[model samples]
Target: MTIKVLVVDDSALIRQLLGEIIRQSPDMQLVGVAQDAYVARDMVNQFAPDVITLDIEMPKVDGLTFLDRLMKARPTPVLMISTLTEAGAEATLRALELGAVDFIAKPKLDVAQGIAEYSQQILDKIRMAATSHVRRARRGESGPPANFVNSGTEKLIAIGASTGGTEAIKEVLRELPANSPAIVITQHMPPGFTTTYAKRLDSICAVSVSEAKDGERVLPGHAYIAPGNLHMHIDKYGADYRISLLDTERVSGHKPSVDVMFNSLAKCAGKNVLAIILTGMGKDGAIGMQAIKAAGGVTLAQDEQSCVVFGMPKEAIRLGAVDSILPLEEISRMALAELNRLGAGTRL
Candidate 1:
């Protein structure tokens, strides 16, 4: 069956480009085009499209407001098309928070050629969005995570996720106490978006969260998010651990890949690590999580029902990389419990 798609963009050029891209795909069909949210709303009702490519900066009604209203009222799979300007970054993040499955950054110039250059990415995101579980926002807790206290063991926790990871990561982090072990995270995202994501989580969580800086020590209570578009790895210098960013070729088809971070954690921290492979779309972290398990580290994989795609964690489970599989809500609490067990020398 050809996947039905609706293009919503104020720019005629962008609409034309996206329409062309959708038409060229044998697996997808462009059902309609709308220049603004008003028309887009009508088209959505008329076409009942399987996926909608929604632009952030539209005339009449801004995409953020429309997205917020749409997700609450009707719920549809949306792939955000946005520019990552400084202000645009925050708006894009909010859009994701609202309900966008994923986004493709709009090129600042050569609109037609740029869209063409990224045609495959556009099509792929659309496909993924169509099959994805569109989750509505259920506001989580504010303030520090439940269990508390700073254990100065110089411990490190590494997390890797993609696809539905943004909210999944937030759910896990929101449960961490002020004195939680230092965390390093790699969430598949576009360039210029990770910084904003880190900031957003920081604002709500008790921990001091920031985009990882190379050579900075991995300190307790602070969470470091790998800067997007760059592969971030853990490095050990004696008892101290810091991050090293690499611009190397994409691993498992992602830059700032989960595999890169998890592998580095397994090699550097070994048994001192507590790692989790959360919701995502590929096998990037399976081998790396297995390495962690081999090195005596405790590993957690989000259970299948809780995952948006179930590809990454499912692969890890198949590979015997996971020590236990937990529902999404239990992960953070269980992580703290396991950390306490390890810190106190109690048997797992």
Candidate 2:
């Protein structure tokens, strides 16, 4: 079945360019195109498209506000098209918070040349968005959870994700406590974005969050995000686990892959580790989670209901690598509770 899509942008040129791209893909079909969010809403109600490519800037109702309202009322997969400017990046991040599944950076130069360069990226994002598991926003609910402290010897939590991971990771990390376990995260993203993302998370999360640096000690109450274009792993020397940043080639088609981190944790931390796989577009972490499970470590995957995309976790579950499948809100709590239990003499 062809993936049905709706394109929403104010610029006629962009709409035409995107339409041509969508039409070229054998597995995808452009159900309709809208000039702005108001018209997009009507198209959404009529076409009920599987995916939507939304431009961040529009005339009447801007993409972010429309996306926010759309998610609150009728949640569906949304892929944002944003410029490379700082303002555009900020808007894109806000769209993620509003529940956008993925995004593509708009061209900065010649329209045709830019489209030619980014066409594959745009198509890939749309395909991924079509598979996302978006949820409608609940009325009067507060933003994602706050970080809390962890009191135990386990000391660390490691997470991995891709595709729809940005928003999903934010939702999970935000709930953690001020003194939470030292966390190592590997999210699939380009170089410039991960630093911004880490900083963004740090501001919202009570714990100290920063991009991982080589040989940095994994201290409790802090989180280290693997930098883009590098693989991050954990290494143990005596009682301390330190971050190891690698310039090695990409594994599983992702530079900062979940498999790299999970494998490292299995070898170094072993029984002392907790690995959680959240929403993503592919199977990067499945085998690594299996390795962790086999080494007497605890593993969890986000369940389909709360996942923006069920690809990674589903793949892990299929491999029998996951010990539990919890919703987004429950993952952090479950991790903490399991750590507390294991630290209290309950073995996996």
lDDT of each: 0.86, 0.84
Estimate the TM-score of every prediction: 0.94, 0.87
Highest lDDT: which candidate?
Answer: 1
**How close to the true structure is residue 265 of candidate 1, measured as C-alpha lDDT?**
89
Residue 131 lDDT in candidate 1: 81
Error of 1 at 210 (Å): 0.9
- Cα error, candidate 2, residue 282 (Å): 0.7
Candidate 1: which pairs clash?
none
In the range 1-348, model 1's lDDT, one tens digit per residue, is: 789999999999888878988999999999999999999999988989999999998998999989998899889989898887767788877887887887887755454455556988888888888888788877755545678443674677789999889989998888888888889999998778898899899998877899999888888889999988999999888777888999999999889898899899889889988999998887988988999999989999999888776889999999989999999889988888888777733212
> Candidate 2, which segments miss by more than 4 Å at Cα?
108-117, 137-154, 344-348
Error of 1 at 188 (Å): 1.5
